[model samples]
Target: MEEQPLISYQHVNVSLQGQEILSDVNLELRKGEFVYLIGKVGSGKSTLLKTIYGEVEIDAGEAWVLGNAMRTLKRKDFPTLRRKLGIVFQDFQLLTDRTVHENLKFVLKATGWKNRTEIERRIEEVLQQVGMENKGYKMPNELSGGEQQRIVIARAILNKPEIILADEPTGNLDVETGRRIVELLQDICRQGSAILMTTHNLNLLSEYSGKVYKCEHHRLTETTNS
Candidate 1:
């Protein structure tokens, strides 16, 4: 039998403060697949991602992520579900007061990693994966925007999540840097993690082929052309 999708949603309605943002949304993400969510600002791209991560509650329809039913997901179950997923933000939300090593270490510790040696080993591995192994001692301010974003990506994969939700991860970088980031994400996907990324950069779509979904008019639709 075929495996179930890592994420699946059908007729999902999402709202905030009594205002509906997304309606009748249907989508799926499978392992090792790379998917893109493209739309104008405030078109509900981020909100859609929020629902998958359980930040935004699903008002109607079926939504499942990593085998958890999001529509009936409880608040206490959020931490367990989140541990199985990774999230990368556009702004590079690294702790400003900590070194790259400490930042990664913090996540490992918070996620129930008890062994000091294991934590160090995992931190080194993720940094190396993102090509930031040597910069772990540096502060967040010491790195360029691209470097900082790399660290952010590294942080996302620390727990070896089943899926990654990246919200415009390349939004603040130059063309070349953004391309590099996308390449890195593709590499991660190939290693068996599904990725659902939101972006306004259409150029990257042409460079890297994948499933594309457009969010517009409070609706989601698959697109053949970027």
Candidate 2:
């Protein structure tokens, strides 16, 4: 039997401020799979992610994410839905006032983690996974763009979320740094978390391997790697 998709969107449509952003969108992501959404800015890449996480409402069609119905999700249930998924952003949104360890700890506490020992262990594990094990004492501004992104990934995985939704995660880095970030995300994906990332750098498409989808002319179309 085939594995069920962690996220699915069929004939979905979305609009913002009376402008149709996406139409008849269809996509699926399974466990341990890495998928990319490549498109120009304002092509609804972010909008799609928003819909998955319930930040944006779908105008039409059916959608499901982690068992939650996107077309009819409730406001009070937002936390319940978000807790099952991780999100990575293009800009590192780390707390400028805290150390790396503190930032991770804050998320844990907010998410209801109470045991100090367990929180420390989980944070250490994620830091090591992202190759930031030795920099947990530093503040966000102290790290380079790539390092900051690594820290963000570490935070995203602290709860062991089943799916990771990344928006332009490599958009702010240099070529080599961006490649490294993608590689790290791929490694995480291999370890079992499905990832759907949006990117403008088609250069990544030629190198890294994954299911590629393009958002253009108000449609999402999967493209083969060339």
Per-residue lDDT tens digits for candidate 2, residues 1-226, read 9877999899999999889999999999999989999889989999999999888889999899987888778899999889888999998889999999999999999999999899999999999999999999999999999999999999999999999999999999999999999999999999999999999998888888999999999999999865
Tens-place lDDT per residue, model 1, 41-113, is 9999999999988888999999999999998888999999999999999998899999999999999999999
- Badly placed stretches (over 4 Å) of model 1 are none
Error of 1 at 26 (Å): 0.4
Q: Which 10 consecutive residues of model 2 have the lowest summed lDDT?
A: 66-75
State the displacement of the C-alpha of residue 30, model 2, in Å, after optimal TM-score superposition.
0.8
RMSD of each: 0.7, 0.8
The CA lDDT of each predicted structure is: 0.94, 0.93
Candidate 1: worst-modelled 10 consecutive residues by lDDT:
217-226
Residue pairs in candidate 2 whose N, alpha carbon or C atoms collide under 3 angstroms: none
Give candidate 2 misplaced runs (Cα > 4 Å). Answer: none
TM-scores for all predictions = 0.99, 0.98
